[model samples]
Target: MTYGEFWVHYLRAHQRTGTRALHYTGSVLALALVAAAAISGDWWLLPAAVVVGYGLAWIGHFAVEGNRPATFGHPVWSLVSDYRMLLLWLTGRLGPHLVRAAEER
Candidate 1:
């Protein structure tokens, strides 16, 4: 599917507010961990960050969303979409995107 199409699918997979909240938490923590790893010169924190990030997101998918993560099929797209969703959310623009995704459904 096209990038635009995948975005809708991505949003649909993250419809629940709690699911997205977990994702946003994971994303923020992951970035902080990465920064810590860089500033401290402890590269091992990089892997830990990945684990923390994906771990929380996986929990959301399985326990909260009751669905598989988009990462399994489209890793690159999923990663990019994760940040896109986060930025839109930070700017309070995510509501429109969510509405658009729901409309497509």
Candidate 2:
């Protein structure tokens, strides 16, 4: 699927507010972890960041949403979409995207 198609599927998979919140939490924590790793010179936190971030996201997918992750199909796009979703959310621009995605479903 193209990136646009995957985005629609991605948003559909993350329809629940709980799932999105978990993703937001994970995304923030991951960013903080990377920052900590850089500032502390402890490279271990890098991998830990990946685990922590994706782990929370996975937990949301399995425990909360009961769905497979879009990551399994499109890792690179999924990664970019995660951060893009976060930024759009931060800027109050996510609702329209979500609405559009919902319409597509």
Candidate 3:
């Protein structure tokens, strides 16, 4: 699927509070890793961060959230969505989606 399509689904999957938390943690991991890589000038640290961060997130999705991660099907888009959701959460807009979903349910 195109990244755009995957983004839509990714956002939907993240509507849940727990799922959003996982995304936030993953974003923080990725950002921290990148920052470390930049500061230490160790390129390899970037990949390590990506793996560790995403690994924790996938585990959270499966074990805690009881859902398959969209990353399995759309890695790039999932990453983009992770950042987008992170921004939304940080900006206090994430709850709107949750509220809307709850209303639908």
Instruction: Report the number of the highest-lDDT candidate.
Output: 1
* Whole-model Cα lDDT of every candidate shown, in order: 0.96, 0.92, 0.76
TM-score-superior candidate, 2 or 3: 2
TM-score order, best first, reads 1, 2, 3
RMSD, model 1, all Cα superposed?
0.5
Off by over 4 Å in 1: none
Per-residue lDDT for 1-105 in model 2, tens only?
A: 788898899999998888989899999999999999999999999999999889999999998999998889888898898999999999999999999998886
Per-residue CA lDDT of model 3 for 1-105, tens digit only, reads 776556566666665566667667877988998999999999999899888778878877887777889878877777777887788779988777556645654
Cα RMSD (Å) per model? 0.5, 0.8, 2.5
**How well is each residue in 37-60 modelled by candidate 1, as lDDT tens digits?**
999999999999999999999999
TM-score of predicted model 3? 0.79
Model 2 segments more than 4 A misplaced? none
Cα deviation of 29, candidate 2, in Å: 0.6
